[model samples]
Target: MTTTKPNMHAVAINPATWPRQTYFYYFTKIAPSGFSLTVNMDITATLAWTKAHHVKFNAVYLYLVSRLLTTHPEMRIGYLNDQLVTFDVLHPSYTILHANRTMANLWTTYDTDFETFYQHYLADQAEFSALPGPMPKTPQTPNLVNIGCLPGVHFSSYTPLPFKPLDSFFPIFQAGQFKKDADKTIMPLSITVNHATIDGDHLSRFFNELQSCWEQPTQYLA
Candidate 1:
């Protein structure tokens, strides 16, 4: 689990000219709101690719979601040091079930290159996967999207209620077990986001692009 911390910085946005400033204010100050949406994403191609490559499906899911989140600037918007800012890149802080039934929180710095990120993910698991505690193996960062998978349960919907205050705007993702729907494999993915930053359009585009990636895993996963 020994790795150098990447040079992370949060760049402030100028509200005067920022297009979403008014929406941000209204959502955060006037009536703070957030929503969650769950969709059954087709993962037939993705599952086959993972099996053929002998790769973990969870890793592929995390990489694809994190990659897509980076593409949408709204998903990366969060407060840093009490100042509104957007991060250069967002990392995936995910849960790893331990042998003793407890879970460990581990994170890997995201990279545009899938192989590099996959190696980092494997290394983190190697070092911390056996730990029986919820404490994070690596230091926590502001630029993170909370991610988890429940491989045993295939549910229709899921909504996450964070114990932390509602001020935090970074998205949270949870993926459920794979379900066979006729000839297609579906995975229920729940995305929880703040309205101050992400809107319905953003979510729609995210899902559309995500489905494309799942449909053509060779293009993105390879």
Candidate 2:
């Protein structure tokens, strides 16, 4: 509930500067004493929005996480014990096209919230559609690059563990209204943690709570 600027400095590095694979990096601190466990929830939900309004899914996703942040202000994301620490926010990986010469690469960028970034995604789609000829599969991740303001963090498509039941729990899909043909989506959230802060049991409970959240996104939308 307090908002004095932090004298502590946490550097937000450009994704281009980071290795494509995940890493255990220092983000922020949790408690005066290091936390003994960390948990990440991969929440998947069935949205009722279309591809055009797919951005709405992002908006709703962001809204839910932002609300959690506001209510649980203590859950702010930062560095803890030399690991990337995130608050109660649900980070979703968004698929975007990336251009590498004639070959276009499909990749994802993490968005802490959906509203702002989805707007940008839609704008870019419009801008690119106006251009000529055989467009690649889709628009590449755009030339715009910044740190932590809008794009948030970038992530690659993560295939969950092969187990079907457990794999079904992760969230990893594009925004679109659920239809018979629309593939089922799961939000697979991932975080690298320092052993000093969290444990596997805590991770299980985190997934449980996250499941509760996605089961009813509106309940937490307040």
Candidate 3:
């Protein structure tokens, strides 16, 4: 799969005019730390839709989260060229486990149109899903959020630490195996974010929106 690098550019925010300036300063300077929240999302509707449409759950999962991330400015905050900025869009840089038990890093550029993005994801998987390596299948853009799945485990809590200092502001997403809770299907989703950019209120709003999406899959998944 040959493609040109995305015209990725971060738009710097004026700290004086930004509403989260104090929170960002306190978190990044006085007490630097990140936070993780894990929620059991009801994916029954999403699963049904995917099954009926013969769509891959992973693709839909990624698409839903990416859409939300791009929608929320707090989730898009990152440092670019030493300036705090927000990305226009965030791509999904996800992991694919190979038959040999190794993992390959693959990513697809996100599009507002679901079909276009879904087809890109399918193409990426078709070309590099089996390749076993730590290297990324495609050239990664600066505007990317790390995403992966642990299909074998359904843990109640999860917290991922940042491996790079620069990645501290970017959100990391993980989803666990789907399990049944009564008549509903539950998927454990873990979101790790820098407190400097995201707060509990922001995270709560994100969950609310995500819940709405899962409850009404036809809105976007269709």
Highest TM-score model number: 1
- TM-score of candidate 3 versus the correct structure, residues matched by position: 0.94
On a 0 to 100 scale, what is the lDDT of residue 30 in model 2?
A: 32
**Candidate 1 worst ten-residue window by lDDT:** 1-10
Q: Write the per-residue lDDT of candidate 2 for residues 1-222, one digit (tens) a residue.
A: 111121222244344564411322322123211222222233444253323344445445544443333333223334434444333332322333335323222212334444444554455444543344444224332211111111233333222233332101122222222223234444434422232333355445544665577666545432
lDDT, candidate 3, equals 0.85
Quote the positional error of residue 63 for candidate 1 in Å. 0.6
Q: TM-score for model 1?
A: 0.95
Q: 1-222 in candidate 3: lDDT tens per residue?
A: 675365467789998899999998899889988889999999999999999999999999999999988789888888777778988888888888878888878888888788888998998888878766786575667787887899999999888754776544878889999999899999999998889998889889999899999999999866
Listed in order, each prediction's TM-score against the native is 0.95, 0.34, 0.94
How would you encode candidate 1's per-residue C-alpha lDDT over 48-135 as one tens digit per residue?
Answer: 9999999988889889998887788899888888888988788888887777778778888788888888898888887777766687
Better of 2 and 3 by TM-score: 3
